[model samples]
Target: MDFRGQISAEFLLIVSFIVVIVLVFSSIAGPQSQENSIATAAREGATGAISEMSYTNVSMKPMRVTGIKITGGSNRVISISFERPVPPEYRALVINRTVESLLTVSGVKPVNSTTVRLGDRTYTVQI
Candidate 1:
């Protein structure tokens, strides 16, 4: 019985197994990382928007950002909503200048309309 060919075959089998394991783990981790990144972008964008608004008017109550939704493919649509109603005119200005400026990542685009309600405002940002 010749042992040389057996050793080479066993080595190849082990290498293939390791490659498969790596691929499996990477596939599992990929979506999770993308989700985390999206969440981070939302939080950062909200924070910057709030800060910008606050800086302009010391008397104005701090605004609460309620949610952020990411849609579309390479040219992404980022929808950010605030709990408090922003004036119709200010909505476009704030999102375009303040919010969009902060979320300057290549493909992300923030929608100009803000969803609002007259109730207790929640600052919680959801991705």
Candidate 2:
């Protein structure tokens, strides 16, 4: 009996099953990986901003931070909420630098300083 066609059918079935399994796993993991990258970038940016503050201002910033990604609006922006609000020395500059660094690490090319609107209020940020 010739079995070539039967074997080819079985092989294709197995391959299709494997591809579907891989796709399902990747879909589950993709968003999680992006979130991790965002968190790392936020930490690095905040740390770099704080380090530079050392030269010009002698104050401390909160070590614990919660960075939330904000989307689904007319504009997309990142929301960085510290355990406490930012300290009051050259505050805007620090924020701008942190924003810039955050975008840079997350695979975005350098962007010029621009204004970001959160609700009715708009603030300048450097990306």
Candidate 3:
């Protein structure tokens, strides 16, 4: 047996092992990072909605609010809801995971019952 060849093989094994470990950890962290990002988006959207709602009050005149859908107005208050479709594999990780947040002129608040399913495995936000 050549000592030089054995040393090279051992080094390669160590490097491969490290790479495998890194890949596994990264895969686990990747989904967590994505979840955090989605949560942030939901919060921001809600705040924007509430801001628009507030403007309806400050306009001094009675603005005919026609539709239930909130529209951007002069007011900074807004309520926003967001939904993300989970992948088959991710569904197992987080079955029907939902997040809801409210934004008011005063501040932001997280409210219960923000996410709902319109159809099978499909989710939406209603504020």
- Which candidate ranks first by TM-score, i.e. highest? 2
Question: Per-residue lDDT of 27-95 in model 1, one digit per residue for the tens?
Answer: 999755654565555656665766677788787677777776765543445567777866564555555
Best by lDDT: 2
Query: What does the lDDT come to for candidate 3?
Result: 0.39
Off by over 4 Å in 3: 59-123
Say which prediction, candidate 1 or candidate 2, comes out ahead on TM-score. Answer: 2
CA lDDT, every prediction?
0.56, 0.58, 0.39
Model 1 regions lying over 4 Å from their true place: 24-35, 72-75, 97-127
Residue 66 error, candidate 1, Å: 2.7
Q: Rank the candidates by lDDT, best first.
A: 2, 1, 3
Per-prediction count of colliding residue pairs?
0, 0, 11
lDDT of 2 at 52: 72
For model 3, how does the per-residue alpha-carbon lDDT over 1-127 read when each residue is reduced to its tens digit?
A: 6587888899999999999999999989975564344445545544444344445446422222122232222222223322432223422212122233322211223433443221122223433
Provide the lowest-lDDT 10-residue window in model 3: 90-99
Clashing pairs for predicted structure model 2, backbone only: none
